[model samples]
Target: MAFVAMGVYGTLSAPVRPLTHGWTLFFFVFNTAPIIPMLGVFAALYATAATRAEREMEKEYQRAENLLLNILPEPIAARLKDDPHLIADEHPSVSVLFADIVNFTETSGRLTPPEIVQTLNAAFSRFDTLVEKHGCEKIKTIGDAYMVVAGLPEPREDHAQAMVSLALDMIDAAQEINESGQFPFSMRIGISSGPVVAGVIGERKFAYDLWGDTVNVASRMESHGRPGIVQITEATRGHLGDEVQIDPLGDVEIKGKGRMRTYTVSRGFAP
Candidate 1:
């Protein structure tokens, strides 16, 4: 499309005839008609270009949000998107679960690094599914250890119950792996419920983590727990309903936190 504006200056300057002036004006108006169509075409192209740009930007924004969600909880990820500042919140009540593969170091010695990673991923992937199924948020994984929590980043009335169910599912998942005879590894799990502070750390490669006495105790419980057992603190035990079966392990000495009563649930859930 092209817009050509005819100059009345050349004709007007050359010679002006009163009778021909009206004809000159009419011809000028006729010549400008093509310009209207040219302007319309330009406007349409601009609008199309703008719409495509907006769609591309929206897609990029969605991709960024998904990446953030993978790193943090949905609520936390939204908060981060609103403000990139440090995110720290104190949760008054939450149940944290820690699970570690028993004899990982010894087992790893028998396999290649790639093989160990593959096996660990296979086991942890199932645990990840259980975490999502039970409405719990996965905190992070350290080596052979997987950490998860219920209630915080979002609140739930039955955090402990959700945690117990997830722990049992994890146990069942690990058992299935062992029975498969492919990189068999028993899991030791520990759980604690109380106050905790959750936050995003590091300016680069930020990670969501939990801190405070509750997390520490949960970690200790896992480290001190026996293989193939789901050990839980008294705080967590109080939340488990009659539907679950637990074997009492009275007042085991915990490092840093004196003697605390603990229990183990071998198999859970009612028929």
Candidate 2:
């Protein structure tokens, strides 16, 4: 249409020229016609590139979000992303479980460094799965010891019961790993229920951890517990109803706390 308009205009204003009108129309069409399509092509290319870049950015953001959630709890991670402040909370009633791989130190001495790490990873990975299954938070792993908690950042009425179920599953998982001949070891688990201050610490590594006497006692329970048994503090045992079976370990000497009676999970989940 532009070429036709230019042709008619050039002919009407030809000024009696011979080939000038035709040349003028040809010049306009030759130069201007290609440019419009070229501009459209460039615009299309830019739009496609921009859309692709946006999708890539979104994917990258999602990957970062998943990594953050893996490091911290979901609610805590969301809060950190929004406010980057110090994340801390105190829960009056929660169950903390600490499980240590039996004879890991001695076993590591006989194996190479890679072998030791692989063994620990395999065992802890299984424990991580169980943590997800029981709706608990795995705080961190200190050497061969794994720490997990139930009832907060979201509180539940039966935190101790959940921990007991998790502990029982962990024992069976460790046994399965041992039976596979990948790493032969047992787990000594301890549970304590009480108040705890949980938060995300360390600017560089950013570890989500717990602090309080309850955390301390839970660690002690794991350290002093016998392998292949799930030990629980009297407080934790009290939280469990008749649905779970527990046997008293009697009054035992705890390092920080005086003689406190503890119990062990006698059987797996009843129902």
CA-lDDT, candidates in order = 0.89, 0.89
Backbone atom clashes (below 3 Å) for every candidate: 0, 0
Candidate 1: RMSD to truth: 4.0
Give the runs in model 2 whose Cα sits over 4 Å from its true position. Answer: 1-19, 268-271
lDDT of 1 by residue, 233-260 (tens): 9999887777688888777787788999
Clash count (model 1, backbone only) = 0
Q: TM-scores of the models, in the given order?
A: 0.82, 0.89
Once fitted onto the true fold, the runs of candidate 1 whose alpha carbons sit more than 4 angstroms away are 1-12, 15-31, 83-86, 109-114, 268-271
Q: Model 1: clashing residue pairs?
A: none
Candidate 2 lDDT, tens digit per residue, 1-271?
9999999998788556465778979988988999998999999999999999999999999998898888999988888889988888999999999999888888788999988888888788989999999999998888888999999999999899899999999998888888888777898999999999999998888988899999989988888899999989989988888777778787768776899898888674544
